[model samples]
Target: MQEKNFITVDGKRFHYMWLRDNCLCPECRDPNSFQKIYDISEAQSPPKPVSVVEEDDKLTITWQEQPIHQSVFPISWLMAHVNELDTPVQSSRKIILWNKTDLQKERTVRHDFHNCDFDVWVNQLFSLGFTILENIKSTQELESFICSMGPIYETYYGRFIAFIIAMRYTLFFPSSLFPLPSSLFPAPKSLLRSPCSEVPKNQRFVPHGYKTCYIPVKPIKGTEAVDLAYSAVGHPLSPHTDFTYLNLGRLLQFIYCEENNASGGESIVVDGYRVARDFRQNHP
Candidate 1:
């Protein structure tokens, strides 16, 4: 069923003007910047869809506006933002909460890269800040897979893969093919350092021009406190988020486990968003 000036997708109603205003077409938005060039406020009247067609998980709308505007919206995108006009008090996106017991049932968070579809991959990444891609063989395959999602952001260290969404989060791939000697291996760099210089201007140990840091969890014997202070090696790190300044505070990270011979390096993932919601409910 359809309402006047609105189209229904999967039983949810979305206004024609809302859909048109949020159109992601290159003509309406800049491809690189992803900023909207066409202002919805400028329109004399609300957009009207002359024809609506749903096929292959896509909603195509042909607008009745002069010059015959047409736009295609992904069913996934529409479903994700179903409550866009809802009261501002509610959270924008619904999150799935899980504990150790939930994790035992089946692998819901991780997906095999070879078998995953584009829509499924996008949904998982969007809903969860992190997703583990299994069975990725080589760097070439990783590059190809990331490029399919969106444009690659090349940095001083390596290519940074970023997706276009509310936040522009970047993915970094560190190569293990060319293993360097312990003496020659570069130290972990600080994200605050300037991109122009190799060393920070303050004469700190922090290295610059590197977007990603490689931390080897393998056990190492006997190291000076000075060296250990500056390095991520042999150091136990508590759970933390990265680079809140960039990409709207939500960074999508992918951790591919190429090899796992060492012990005591188990990964832990906690749904911070879910925890916050629970806390608010209990307290208030």
Candidate 2:
């Protein structure tokens, strides 16, 4: 039986496999990462759309197979990619950057907490990288509001990360023996430890409107050197985790070096839940 592609937006009909492959739904694509979980070639059979409907400038397609799935594509997305869809692969679109004036213009936006369109907030976050949200009642409210967008990706932090500031201000401190910033200064009860920084920056964020001065600690011999080259090339390097911003999370995978010239620490996979269970049984 021949299936016709009735999904049309902006006078452009998207290919079946392309639409299926680029499915923005949480199942086919990771809600957090935005990576495609659905692969076109390895599919058991070609993507066959049995039903297509267009509403509110979105095309929804239901596949003609078991383990039912649907793909939704926005009209704007289809219109922008009309030409690119025909190509083998397409380059990523450049990010939209803004200046201080652009941010000041947004200040006029009245944040009505009760009647909120989180979709607009999500769009603002995607385009501007960061959008200010205030007057959220509690962590529960925040979680519920956030989950309205997609599935929750549980963070490894001891508590919830309700707020995250995007801008990175790298501060170089002279102290070599400092503990990891998050562990050192814990976030107050519920809120996240603001500005999770990379290991390179040995300092926390100092907000503007405060005049501050720093006196560098005297360098001691046999201490870790603050050099990017040293971190990359130095053998038997200091103990540290990769992607420190992630803070020892469950997800990220360890990769083998492409050119294995020198040996690095073994990549250990530990089941966090299992470890916690054993610890509780033994200790309690």
Candidate 3:
């Protein structure tokens, strides 16, 4: 057995363990069942490849051991796992930064849900950090649309939470002044008088275990005397990405606007990656 756990096959290097695990022979893998018959731990030492040959995309390897004397691999399968084998494949699509002129030229970025293809939608999202999707009639339709792409990534905030000031009036009272009921302390529905008895089941936006908090952007009539933080006074929120510490980072943040009567709540987006690139180029 060779100490080096790699072998060059058809000009591509593959791990010995990876090659051994993917053995397609009838002894290693059941012909009818297709399940692996050989246990990975059964190999006492690294199985070394003594001979390797390629014919018409098929790769054959002769090992220097018994019970798993030979193995065959397809070139296509080997190429597909090139990244896993520590080979980097360059991507064709480059990230493009947009200016005001670029935004004007690409004004028709909004895709209609009824008419858009999945690949087109995904491509647009990949190219641009965010995209506008119009004509999504209801919440159910939006949920269904997202579910089609993949599972909804529930975070510390849970699946979804809509911030409506009126619904969370009870939360404004200090816990010292008005101690919260044990049932109403943690859950979003605790703020409600009757836990969504009035709203229809389907229309209920906040799912169970979802956390909710409401901050008034505009000052209420009586609360004008109390000085508040800049955020409470409708100041521009500092641009930031959410949940970067978590695995994969927050996948996406969806904002649904029901109404926009108040001022100074406009959305701002900046490509952090593009900014870093520009900074490095200029500074260096």
TM-score quality measure for candidate 2:
0.32
- Residue 245 deviation, candidate 1, in Å? 4.2
In lDDT terms, which candidate is top?
A: 3
Report the CA-based lDDT of candidate 3 relative to the real structure: 0.52
lDDT by residue (138-254, candidate 1, tens digit) is 445654665565544423224422111110121111221111000111222222235622432223332222233333222222132232212223343334443322333223344
C-alpha root-mean-square deviation, candidate 3: 20.3
Candidate 1: C-alpha lDDT: 0.50
lDDT of 3 at 105: 81
Clashes of 1: 0
**Any runs in candidate 2 off by more than 4 Å, and if so which?**
1-6, 84-284
Model 2, residue 277: displacement in angstroms? 53
Q: Tens-digit lDDT track for model 2 on 1-284?
A: 12363355666666676688678896765454444446555678868887788889887888886888888888787887785523343335333445545556664333555775767765665455445455655445544565554444433422232111111221221110011112111112222232333322333322111122222322211123333212222223222243345543333211211122222323332333344466458644
Q: Against the unseen true structure, what C-alpha lDDT does each candidate score?
A: 0.50, 0.43, 0.52
The candidates, ranked best first by lDDT, are 3, 1, 2
Worst 10-residue lDDT window, candidate 1 = 176-185
lDDT tens digits, residues 94-209, model 3?
54576556657864668887898767667666676678887766445655666665676654444544433222122111100001000111122333445443432112223333
Q: Could you tell me which 10 consecutive residues in candidate 3 have the lowest summed lDDT?
A: 175-184
Best-first order by TM-score: 3, 1, 2
Clashing pairs in 3: none
